[model samples]
Target: MNMTPAPKAVVVGAGPVGCLSAIALAKLGWDVVVYERRPDIRADSLQASSCEIPARIPRPRSINLTLSARGIAAVQSIDSTLVERLLYNAVPLQGRMVHHLKGNPTPQQYDRQGHCLYSIERGLVNLIILETAAAVKNISIKFSHKAVGVDFKNNVLRLCNSVTGQEFDENFDLCIGADGSNSIIRHFLMRATQMEYSQHYLSHEYVEIRLQAGKNSSGDTFLLDSDHLHVWPRGNFTVVAMPNKDKTFTCALFAPREMFDNLQYPDALIPFFQAHFPDLLSLLGEKRLLSAFQNNPRSQLITVKANLYHKGSVLVIGDGAHSFVPFFGQGLNCALEDVRILSALLCEEKGGCDPSAIHRVFKHYSESRHEDLIAIGDLAMDSHLKMRRSVATWSYTIRAYIDNLLYALSESLFVVKLSQTIFGPESTGWIPLYSMVSFRPDISYSAAKKKAEHQKRLVDSVGISLAILGLGYILHAFINLNKLL
Candidate 1:
C-alpha cells in the first residue's frame, strides 16, 4: 500500500513568529522549510549561548517586549520545557514604576491578583525559539536565503542566496508569510487578490540607550528596581526602561520626530536631557546620554493592517498580517497566539492534508480571526496615548481603581452567586478590559472589546447618577441652612 507523503510547508522569515510557525508545522508531521534573509542568529559568535545569560549588546535601535499570559500560554501549548528555557533569564515585572521629575516614583500594579509580565531580551527569545526549531525533526532552516518573489498561481517562491549570489525557485504545498511588517509574501498576495491593505506611520520615533549596571555602597550591582517597569512620562513623550539579566537596563526614548530633528548634535542633547529628564540624566550620566543621542538610529513607528490574511495556499501571520505600536506590549504575544490558533485549526482537519480542506481551514481562520486582530491593533495604538500622558493623571488612576474594584468584586464567590441569582448566568462574571485582553486566553479579542464597551457605558451611567445625587444633597443642605438662619 502506497501511503500519502506528508504535506510540505514553506515559511518565510526566521523571527520568533516564523520559528514558532516552523515548529508548529513540523510537529503536525509537515515537511517544513524556513527561509530567512539575514544570516542565522544562532551562528553569530557574539550572541549569548543557550546555556548562558544574555548581555545587552549596543544596537542602533531595539524594542523590548513583555511576555504576559498570552505569550506564556502559547509557548506552553508548543512545549512546556520551551517556556522554562525562555523565562530562565527573564525578569518578573509586577508593576509599573512611574518616574516623576521632582518626587518619588509611584507603583501601579498590572493586575489585582498579582499577575505579572516577564521582561526578556527579544533577541534572546528569538534565539531560543530558533534553537527549538533546529531540534525538531523534518524541519530545514535555510539562512541567507532571501525571498525575492512569489508565484501565487503556482505556489512557488523565488529566492536568492546572498552568500552564493544564486537565484532559485521552490514549490510547496502551503506558504506562510511570517515575514514582518514589510512582508514580501504579503506584497505578492495583494497583487494577486483583493487584499485591502493600510499602513499608518505615527509622528513618534524611538532610540535605544543602554544603562550600565551601577554599584551600591556595599559593592553590589544595583540601579533601578529590577522588579518594576520604569516609565518617565513627560506629557508629550516618554522614556521607558526594562531590566536585563546582566544587571543593566535597556531604555528607549520615544519622542516626536521634530523633537529628534531639533537635537541634531551632542551639545543640544545635554541641555535637553538636563531640562526634561534630570533624574534620568543623572542615572545615565550626561556624557553617555549625549553619545547615545548623537550615535543611535531613530526608528519610525508604523501600524500595518490588512483585511484579508490568506489567498489560496498562502497565509500571513504575526506582524505581517497586523503590525501595531508597542505601547500595549501585545505585538509579540499576539503573533505567538496566531501560531497557536492556526496550528490548532490545522490539526482539526478531517481528511489529513487535503488541499481543499486546507483551503477551507485558511478561510475559516481569516474570517474568524480578522476582527480580533483588528481590535488588538486599535487597542495597541490607543494604549500609546494612555502610556505617554494619561498614566500620570488622577482621573485615569481613579478610573483604573474603579475598574479593578469591579473586577475583583465580580470574582468573589458571594458576589458571583448573588449576581447569578439576581441577574442571570451571563452576568455572573466581570473582568477589566486589560485583564480580559492580557490575562484571559479563552476570551476572544472582539468579545473582550465588546464587553469592555458595555462595561464603560455602565460605569459612566453610575458615575453620572452619583454626581447628580451628591449635587442635590449639597443644594438641599444649603437651603436648610438658609431657612434656619
Candidate 2:
C-alpha cells in the first residue's frame, strides 16, 4: 500500500502571523514555505555593529506592541517555550499611567488581580517568531521574495526575487496570506471571489519618539515607572510611552494629520508640546522633540475589514483579513489568535495532510473566525476615543469602577452563592468587559462584545434610576422645609 505525501503550504509575508502559521503547519507534519518581502531581520541584526542601537531607538518610526492575554495564550498554545523566549526581554506594564498637565499622573490598573500587558519592541517579537520558524526542519523561509500575484485556479503564487530581479511561480496545496493590511494575496482574492472589503483611514496619524534611559532623583535607571504604560491624553490626540527592557521608553505622538502638517517646521513643535503635553517636554527634551518632529515619518492609522477570508485553496489571516488601529493594542494579539484557532481546526480534521480535506478546514475556519475578527476590529477603533478622551471623564471612570466592583463582588463567597441561587447553575457570573476581552481566552470576542453591551445597558439603567431617586429626595426636602416655614 502506498501513502500520500505530506501536504505543502505556501505562506506569504514572513511576519509574526505568517511565521506562526508556518510553525503550526510544520508541527502538523506539513511542508511549509514562507516568502518574505524584506531581508531576514535576524540576519540584519546579526550583521549590524554591537554598538548600533536597534531600529527601535533614536529613529522615530518604531511602534511598540502590547502583548496581552490573547496573544500570550495563542503563542502558548503553539509552544510555551516560544512565549517564554518572546517575553524574556519584555517589560511588564501593570496599567496605564494617565499623565495630567496640572497634577501628578494617575495609574489605572488593567485588571483587579494586577494582570498586565507585556511591552515588547515590535521588531524584536517579529524577529523572534521568524527565527523560530527558521529552526523548524519542515519550514523553509525565502527572504527578499515579494509576492506580486496569485493564480487561484492553478493554485500558484507569483513572486519576484528582489535580489535577482527574476519572477517565478510556486504551486501549493494551500496558500495562506498573512502579508498584512496591503496584502497582495488579498487583492487577488478580491478579484477571484465576491469578497466584501472596506478600509477606513483615521484622520489621526502618529510619529515615534524615544525617551532616553537615565537615572531619576531616586537613582533608578527608569525615568518613569516601568511597570505602567504612560499616556498623555489631550482629547483630540494622545501621546503614549511604553517601557523597554533597556529602561528607555518608546513614545509615540498620535495626532491629526493637520496638527502634524502644521508643525512642519521644528520651531512650531515647542508651543504645541508646551500647550498640549507640557509635562512631556521636560522628559523628551526640546531639541530632540523638534528634531523628531522635523525628521520622523508620519504614518496613518487604518482599519481594514474583509469578509470570506478563504477562497478555494487560498486563505487570508492576520492583517490581511482584518487590520485594526493600535489604540486597543489588539492587532497583533488578534492576529496570533487567528493562527491558534486555525491550527486547532485543521488538527481536528481526520485526514490531516489530505488535500481533499483542506477546503473543509478552510471553510470552517473562515466561518468560525469572521465575527470575532470584526468584533475586535470595531472594538479597537472605538477604543481610540475611550483611551484619548473618555478615560479622563467622570462617567467613564464611574462605569469602569462599577464594572470592576461587580466583578470583584461576584467572586465573593456570599455573592457567588446568592448569584447561583438567584440566576441558577447556568449563570456565567460577572466579568468586566476588558477582563473578558483581554484576560479570558475562553470567552469568544463576539460573546464578549454581546456581554459588554448588555452590561452597559444595565449600568445605564441603574445610574438613571439612582439619579431620579436623588432628585426626588431633594424636592421632598425642599417641600418639607417650605411647609415648616
Candidate 3:
C-alpha cells in the first residue's frame, strides 16, 4: 500500500509566531522546516529549566509582551500544555499601576471581573515555542540559515548558511514569512508582485532599563507591585516595567527622538530623570540608571502594513504582514493570532493538507486576514497617542473611568436584565473596546475598532446627558427651596 506523503512547508523566521506556524502545519501532516538567521539560542547547552535566574536576560532586544486572550487562545489552540509552561515563566499583571510625577501611584484594574494579562519575556516565549516545535517529529528548526532569496513562481527559497558561507535552494509546497517587520521573504515577495507597502517610523524610541529584585525587611522578593504593570507616564515620555519570574523587572522607556537625543550623554541621564521621574531614581539608583542610559540601544518604533499578504504559494504572517507600535501591547498577541487564523484556514481546506489547494488557501487567508491586520495597525498607532500624550491628562483619566464604569454597569444591570428578558437572547450586550481587543479573542480587530468607535460615541453622549440631568435636578430643587423661603 502506497501512502501519500505529507505536504511540505518552509517557514522563515523562528520567532514565536514562526514556531507556532511550524507546529500547526506539522500537526496537520505537513513536514515543516523553519529557517532563522540568528544562531540557535539553546546551542550553548543552556539549562532546560527556565528557573535558573540570570542576572540579566542575554538578549538586548525584547518588547516585554503580555499574553492576552487572543495570544493565549492561539497558544492553547496549538498545544494546551504550552500555556501552562509559559504561565510558569510569566507574571500575572492585574492592571497598570500608573506612577505620577507628584502623588502616590494609582492602580487601575484591567476589568471589573479581574481578567489578568500574563506578562512574559519575549525570549522565553520564543524558546518555549521553539522547544514545542522541536518536539514535533515533522518540524525541523534550522538556526543561522538566513533566507537570502526566493523563487515565488516555483515555491523555491534560497538560503545562505551563515556558518559555512554556503548557499542552497530548497523547495516547498508553501513558504511562510514570520521573519518580523524587516522580513527578507516580504522583500522578495514585493519584487514578485505589485505589493503596496508602507512603513512609518514614529518619533518615539525605546531603551531598556533593568531593575534588580528588591528585598523587603522579610527578605522576600518585592519591587513595586509584582502583580501590576508599572507605568511612569509623562506627557511625551513614558517608562513602563513588567515583572519577570527571576524576581526582577524588565523596564523600557518610550520617548520622542528629540528627548532621546537630548539625553545622549552620561551627565544628562540623572538630571532628566530628576526632572520627569524624580521618585524612580531611588528604585533604579544612580549607577544603574546611568549605565542603562549609556549602554542600552535606543530602538525606533515602526509601523508596517502591506496591501497583499500572500502571492502564489508564499505568504507572510505576523510582523511580516503587519507590524505595530508597542503602545497597545498587541504586537505579540496580534502575531500569535495570525498563526491561529492561518491554521484554521488551512484546516478549512477541503482536502486537508493537500499541496494542490495551496494557492486557493493562501488567497482566502489573505482576503480574510488583511482587514484585521490593518485595523490593528491603526489601533496600535492610536494607542500610542493615548499612552504618550493623554495618559497623564485628567480628561483621559475621566474618560477611562467613565468608560469602565459604563462597561461594569452594562455587564451587571443592563446586560443581565436584557439577556433574561423575553427578547430571545442572541446578544452578548456591550463589550468594552479594551476588553474586545484584549480579553475577547472571538472579536476580530476590524470589528473591535468599529464597535469601539460606536461605544465611545455612546459613552460620551450618555455621560454628557447624565451630567446635564443632574445639574437640572439640582437647580430645580434649589429653585423650589427658594420659593418656599
Point to the candidate with the largest lDDT: 1
Tens digit of per-residue lDDT, candidate 3, span 37-101? 99887533323344333344445466588998778887777777777788877889898888888
Tens digit of lDDT per residue, candidate 1, span 365-397? 899889999999888888899889988888989
In candidate 2, which residue ranges exceed 4 Å CA deviation?
1-3, 44-60, 216-220, 412-427
What's the ranking of the predictions by lDDT, best on top? 1, 2, 3
Off by over 4 Å in 3: 43-57, 216-220, 350-352, 412-427, 464-485
Quality of model 2 by C-alpha lDDT:
0.83
Pick the winner on lDDT between candidates 1 and 3.
Answer: 1
Q: List TM-score per model, in order.
A: 0.93, 0.92, 0.91
- Cα lDDT of all candidates, in order? 0.83, 0.83, 0.81
Q: List, residue by residue over 1-485, the lDDT tens digit for candidate 2.
A: 99977888999989999999999898888899999998766745522113222444222276798898778888887766678776776898888999976788988889997778999887777777877788888999999999888888889999999999999999899999999899989999999899999999999999988888887686648878999989988899999999988788999998899988888875687888898898788888999898777777888898899999988889999999998898888888889988888887777774356666788888888888888888998788788888788887778788888889899887432122211111113227677878878876666788888888988899889989999999999999999999999
TM-score of 3: 0.91
For candidate 2, which ten residues in a row score worst on lDDT? 415-424
Better of 1 and 2 by TM-score: 1
Better model by TM-score: candidate 1 vs candidate 3: 1
Top model number, TM-score:
1
